[model samples]
Target: MTQLTDPSGQPPYLRIVAGIRRRIMDGELSPGDRVPSTRQIAKEWGVALATATKALTTLRLEGLVEARPRTGTVVAETAPARPPRRPSPPASPSEQELTLERIVRTAIDIADAEGLSALSMRGVAARLGVAAMSPYRYVPSKDDLVLLMADAAFGDETYPADAPQGWRSRIELGARTLWAVYRRHPWLAQLGSLTRPLLVPNLMVHGEWMLSALDGHGLDPTTLFDIHVLIYSHIQGLAVHLEWEAHAEAATGQSEDQWMDSRADVLRELVDSGRFPTFAKVVGAFDDGYDLRLDALFESGLKALLDGLAPIVES
Candidate 1:
């Protein structure tokens, strides 16, 4: 089996690990010294976040580095000089066999596992066990690749021919379908905004589904489009936080609950301070500390939004 190499004649992640390992072995990065973060590594080495993450994971496996919660990754106190181990190259077909579909699917998987920030042409090629530029042959650039990914992701679901009856039911199905896609690929919400929407065929399938639901209602075009946009905003607005929370956890090494617990003392003080009685009462009402379930929130918000718009849409 042939080992894939980047331009440097070594796998990108290994090269990164070697660089950091050399720094540790040379005492440049002493024990407990802060090591460059994943973002920093990516920026400094011109690699993707996934590549940087892999380098850090290698170092941790070698016991050369350790994570220090809010402090970021640091050189372990007892660093042993061990040569970096080469990862077993993945079994992949030659670049000649690579297809556009394969490239887009691989890119989507990368963005899904890691955040969108972690995706890059080189990273996808690396995962596919091809040369760094192999993916670029199929996808002109990362931006184009992302658009392909979005289209493919949105295309995952389709409305059945026997669609649910009633405008509200049809609209509900469309909204839930979109929310499900965002739930699967949280990075998707970060792709486009309301003003600048992602104009892709598969996404248009969703838009068409939604717009058609509101059609034949004797409603003016402006009011009809307004309602459509409003519904989309609710799903996209909340979905944006999904990626954000994942990013926060990755950067801070704390889950939402853990991070909130870390600030419990401050929250307790804020609640006890007699300044805001109403706010305190709301905080006091929860039998158990609030667990922010985004799914529940999405359902509740969707129902309320549809309920409020029922009169206008029905009329």
Candidate 2:
């Protein structure tokens, strides 16, 4: 039980903080264990994203949780002195220092470390060590902030002025580069869809690279753009699972391998039941078990895609 009986009109975020803190105190959520992501908190408690973000932010400030690289937020290894459950106001800072670039950079860091749903304007400001509304000064809303963040993230990589020798090679390079970004920042793939794309300058740099490559290769404008979209879809289609799996792991408190192991009996039953013979045969062949390497999978798919595109480009 999380001590939530208080009748005072305390904000929702403080109650959230207390519940999680109770979890920590009770040993249910141990040191080195992953904490539920902001998305999970929001969904479970029926609070807004900002409220969930604030709760985590308050916990972090109080030393109950610490943001770990590669791993999302986790319980701090050693507890520090208990501070107030509610967050204190951030110390005032000069307003002249804030800039659009700094805001976007901080937002990208948050979205990369945490998932996109974890992102909030207040969260970004907290990360920047400024007033909660500071980010709003430069980026009007969360939506506009996301647009700038996408542009900055995509701008991280660009093609060389002298392009690759062949159109296929250029396309491969472009796809790999984009995949690298998504691999680093999985949240980027979940941005706008293929039909309603984000039309920003930096992202357009990539579009221009691919579009230009497919341009003089005998395909009409529509077909050229369509090929570009197809290649992008290949990356985005698979990239969604990257963040989703991460989110699921954090929320469920189980790694993929751990979760699968828990279902081993079910799997064995399925294998022995004789319904999925081909599945059993293939899985049974791997004594050491199969390793699902997304990197290898991406490379394999990219190669197959380029092979299919070869005839069209070469023609």
In order of appearance, the predictions have TM-scores of 0.73, 0.71
Can you tell me which runs of candidate 1 are displaced by over 4 Å? Answer: 1-96
Task: Give the Å error, residue 286, model 2.
Answer: 1.2
lDDT of 2: 0.80
lDDT of each model, Cα atoms only? 0.85, 0.80
Total backbone collisions for each predicted model: 0, 0
Q: For residues 18-39, write the lDDT of model 1, one tens digit per residue.
A: 8899999988999999888776
Error of 2 at 301 (Å): 0.6
Once superposed on the true structure, which residue ranges of model 2 sit more than 4 Å away at CA? 1-92
Number of the top lDDT candidate:
1
